[model samples]
Target: MTRALILFAHGARAATWAAPFERLRELTQARVPGVPVSLAFLELMEPRLPERVAELAAQGVTAVTVVPVFLGQGGHLLRDLPLIVEQLRLDHPGMAISVSGAVGEDPSVLAAMTDFCVAQL
Candidate 1:
């Protein structure tokens, strides 16, 4: 089964806010050569989660792993995401969809951010 990774983030009105996410997608895509890696926004951006997932499903991707790039488990993660995922599941029943925790909650990511902050001192 073909699998893909979708880096999910809360989009901003400023177009430049997506630069980092786009870069993250590129870096991730490079790590997993064959697996499709993409970026999807929550709002104020194009290719929302459902749209991206549908594209993947159309491409015959049977599995999708969504990684929320948010900094914490806020309302967006607590409520919005579940609802969106529910619809995505219904929309693409043949595809297996799973979601990972917020990237900021990961110890490794937190450590990296800590390191950057420390360097600033």
Candidate 2:
């Protein structure tokens, strides 16, 4: 079963907002050499989550893990993501899709952010 990792983020109107996400994707891709690591946005972006997942599905990826790059669980995460995932499930029944909590919610991520903040002083 071919598996892929998708760093899902809320896209912004400004193109520069995607720079960090792109970097994260590249870093992740390097770590998982054979596995596919990609970035997909929720809106105001070129490749929306559904579209990216479809592309992966077409490429014979049987499983995908979606990691939300958002700082917190807001409306987009609480409302929009579930609906999208539901539709994706129906659209690609053969594929297994699972979603992790927002990156900001992770303890390690929070610790890292805290360290960065402390260093700013």
Candidate 3:
């Protein structure tokens, strides 16, 4: 089964808000050439989670892992995301969809950020 990775982010009204996420997507896609990678936003952006997943499903992706590109376990991640995932589950019963912890909360990420913070001093 074909597998894909989706980097999920909270979109903003500003177009520039997506640039970072797009760059992240590109970086991840380069690292994992075997599995396709894409980005989807929670709101105020194109290709919302469902649409992106549906497109992937149409392209024959059997499994997908969603990694929230957020800093903390905010309402979007804790509340909104689960509801969206549940809908996706119901919408695509055959697909295996799973979610991982927020990127900002990851140990490695936090370490990097901490180093960056120290450097700024």
Candidate 4:
């Protein structure tokens, strides 16, 4: 059961915002240890979700899980992500794919974000 993890982020025009996501991918890899991980963007940034999915498929991954990095169940997650996932499903009919909830809406994540904001002021 080969599995791959795709970390999807809302793309940024500045490019610098992507650096943190790269760091995040590294951290996730370290934590998970065995699951193959990679980063993908919704827009602006390169290597869109479909492309990442293709890459994972090429690497012989039989299943892939997509993790959205957004803060809420916004239009991107509710509409765009499912569209992308459906497309990928068609494109990779042999591979099993699943999309997880947005990371930002997690309780621990919201608390951490609030802590960071409060500490700054």
lDDT of 3 by residue, 21-116 (tens): 999999999999999999999999988999999999999999999999999998999999999999999999999999999999999999999999
TM values, all candidates: 0.98, 0.97, 0.97, 0.94
How many clashing residue pairs are found in candidate 3? 0
Report how far residue 121 has shifted in candidate 2, in Å: 1.5
lDDT of each: 0.96, 0.96, 0.96, 0.92
What's the true lDDT of residue 95 in model 2? 100
The lowest-lDDT stretch of 10 consecutive residues in candidate 2 is 101-110
lDDT of 2 by residue, 77-110 (tens): 9999999999999999999999999999999989
What is the C-alpha local distance difference test score of candidate 1? 0.96
Query: What residue runs in model 4 are displaced by over 4 Å at the alpha carbon?
Result: none
Q: Residue 67 of model 2: what lDDT?
A: 96
* Residue 73 local lDDT, model 2: 91
TM-score rank, highest first? 1, 3, 2, 4
lDDT of 4 by residue, 7-29 (tens): 99999999789998999999999
